[model samples]
Target: MKQPNAAKQHKPLWTKAFLLTSLSNLLLFFSFQMLIPTIPTHISQLGGDDAQVGLVIGLFTISSLLTRPFAGKALDSLGRKHVLLVGLSICALTIAGYSYMAAITLILAARFVHGIGWGMSTTSLGTVIADIIPAERRGEGMGYYGLSNTFALALAPLTGLWLMNAYGFLRVLQLSTCLALLSLLSSLFITYPKPPMPFEKPAQRPTLADRLFERSALLPSILLLCTAVCYGGIVTFITLFGREAGISNVGWFFLCNASMVLIVRPITGLLFDRKGPEWVLLPGAFFTIAGLLLLSYAHSEANLAAAALCYGVGFGSLQPALQAWTIARAAPNRRGAASGTFFSANDLGIGLGAMALGALATYCGSYAVMYRYSVLLMVVFLLIYGWCLWQAKRVVRLFGRTSN
Candidate 1:
């Protein structure tokens, strides 16, 4: 009887709800990824200058940042279904709207709205996954869930580009809109958990800070931000860097990177659950640093592939580990806020890293040199993590002394 009870306690991670949510997440990301590489080209074709092309991304980022906190608040207070449905509706409509926009300004406006929906939908999806997955298997569950994104990233851009070449831009938008609608449809079937009611008395209303962010999640989120910064530099400039190095086929780098990530993520996730973050993080950072340094000097496809594989291992290990850590630290009621905080930090880091590293590349007169400097960001990540550990130990020691 006791053995049966113990077996029952180990709830399955791959439930129907989890699968539906993951499917929805996969479709959502696939639709969004297909648009990312094509949108700038669309703006350029519509008589927009380079500055306006940049605004297409910039305005979207700003709107997403503005919407995330409120989305988080709504998810925790109003429940997941409402926020998820509203966000998916906005995404589907905005994607369809993109097909009809004639002017650059209209496209930019639509992109901004799309970002708001992106932020809300992503946050809600993350919270829903957290609610459904078994606590003990969270790292493993998140690893599997994130594969949807990895597969989308690897396939969507290529597919989008192919569609654009064959049928033109309008077809791309129509297909992306259809994908968003399918994502929305899949989401409707998910049985969401009830919203976690506040434990505080009615008179004790939540504060502004309470509604905006999860305090317990900040530490791991900071570490995640540092990694995102390095990632931003890579994704933004790697193609240019390859050209600067006299390499023609830079696409191979992403293919190798994605392959390596697919291999390492599940293993790293299991290690994080059983061994601890230190087992994954230190080696992950080392691999990332090695990858960046190699990439700075890579002049051949083989070298580029090697660098990509190394970076893939590092980033693939770090991202899900930090996210699982963030979710683990937060109360059940605050998981939505925690996910929002995690994503917000990631967005802030990427935006800042791109802008700052672009300036560095300009100043140094070489994208290769810019990558060399980007390694410093990862170094900072390791240092900050070490300091956090020391602080934790010191507080523990002081408490022990006081008790004595």
Candidate 2:
């Protein structure tokens, strides 16, 4: 029950390492986002249809999901730095490979390879941070880390689109490859902390409760899954949807959305550190739900902009809170597994949601239908979470009474 002492805890070496790692992730994500706005269009240019585009995008996620458990276990055994370097190097190479391929199949292969690298890098970096950051400040640290990616998400797509318009897709691809290489190089400067070994003895097996509940840890994980599902719908289909709705300059909508996230994330982090996640969750959820609704009804550029602001605020606030909570409740030895689990759920929600939404859009003849469906899903998640919170409080009260 004793909380880590804030005054006594020194600035951890892993914190600096995590900052570098986060920067690498930022660049990597930036490069990917740069490609995102153009990828479907490129696939179309290459004579692929919507189904093929969906397949290509889905391949990346499928590869990532399949590799995560292995990546997590490897990070636990092989150490973080080794896995980090391997992942980043592979990522850099894959980005370069994109330039050499015009075939849809080859592009899908490259994305799959990129997904493997993403799985390794993300799992290792998260595990390494878990080893370094203090529980009390974990929320704050994770928030800052999340901000790095959000910053990239904000700038990368617009910049990439502009460059693509100016110089061409080939030149944009070259820029992305260079950024990925920079990310790979950045890993060399990161000094990863030594992670604890896995428990070996039969008696050292974690309890059923530890495996199932993770108690407070489940809070963030569930919230993350919900948020990811919502985000997946927007990120994957919004631009295409906008184009369908006869909106011009769909890229600007993404730019505004990312900008709002970048602006709001740090403030949310500060709030999480001082006020706890409970206070932040409801408002964030509201914004997201509202954003999705507005997006569904968006008939003008102004409506799209308003939706972006709402969506950004919602997403920016909740993501870090969930990450911090997941790490905070995990035992140090199992933190890698815990982070993997968290990310697995996140990946599953996002990947599945996108795929399903794509299918729905195909049949429904409107992206708005998908948005409405997601709003329903969000409502379900909120109900489940609310019930869980109530149950948790009841258990705590009962335990306190029995103890007394």
Best model number under lDDT:
1
Clashing pairs in 2: none
User: How does each model score on lDDT?
Assistant: 0.88, 0.77
- Residues 1-404, candidate 2, lDDT per residue (tens digit)? 23445454445534567777788878888888888777777888899988888776788888887777677766766777888789888888888888889888899888899999888777777777667666666766777788778777778877888998898888888999898898888878987767875456547676744443334455567777877887787878877888887887666667778788777877886677677766667677888889889889887898889888888888877787777767766666667667777787788889877877879888898898889878876686678667766776787898853210
The best candidate in terms of TM-score: 1
Estimate the overall C-alpha local distance difference test score of candidate 1. Answer: 0.88
> How many clashing pairs does model 2 include?
0
lDDT of 2: 0.77
For each predicted model, how many residue pairs clash, with residues at least 3 apart or on different chains?
0, 0
Question: What TM-score against the true fold does each predicted structure earn?
Answer: 0.95, 0.87
What's the TM for model 1?
0.95
